[model samples]
Target: MTETESKARVAKFHIGQVVKHRIFPFRGVIFDIDPVFNNTEEWWLSIPAEVRPRKDQPFYHLYAENAETEYVAYVSEQNLLADTSPEPIRHPQVREMFVRIEGGAYRPRDLRVN
Candidate 1:
């Protein structure tokens, strides 16, 4: 297999993986995976958008969730774990539901009452 195919793609992680952001309390699905840039030895996960930084500069070394800043932590292959088992402790920010209320094309609800 080509290096790009292997390294550029995010490594697979099962759902309910008990992954903690090396530097943030935000942890969720391995929902997506993308291999590290040019570096086959690393991997990037599809973490929550709130936990993620801007796209211009992607990827960060894993650090303790309590880490004060990015400089203090280091993420490597060793830091990554593959465990699909669920966590007993629920995350604080877990949204209970995503109610998708579609808005019709600028039609005001008041019009129906008239």
Candidate 2:
């Protein structure tokens, strides 16, 4: 196998892990992870070129919170860090998707769609 093909892409964060932006003042819980950029070009272009993340890395979908309010955010893996705070997330939507928090991880309610 080629060198690049042999290197598996490992997601650093899991579906229920809590995380915060490396350069932003907000935190969130991971709702989903994409192996690489899966958003629209319009959305990607919104970020300034100098700081924009590469498309080859993992991207996360989050139930996010700031000092003022809660919302959703799409963030690149390079920009995220694990949130070690023991306190549970307060986003209202969290309850709809996650059943509980156990050992600092959110437990997603299984909603299988065929």
> Which candidate has the top score in lDDT?
2
Give, for candidate 1, the lowest lDDT window spanning 10 residues: 99-108
Q: Give lDDT per model, in order.
A: 0.32, 0.89
lDDT of 1 by residue, 2-109 (tens): 644444434333322334544434333222232443233322345354553322222333212332322222233223543233432232322221111232111112
Q: What clash pairs does model 2 have?
A: none
Where is the poorest 10-residue window by lDDT in model 2? Answer: 1-10
RMSD of each: 13.3, 3.1
- Candidate 2 lDDT (Cα, whole model)? 0.89
> What total of clashing residue pairs does each candidate reach?
6, 0
TM per candidate = 0.29, 0.86
Q: Could you tell me the lDDT of residue 91 within candidate 2?
A: 96
TM-score winner:
2
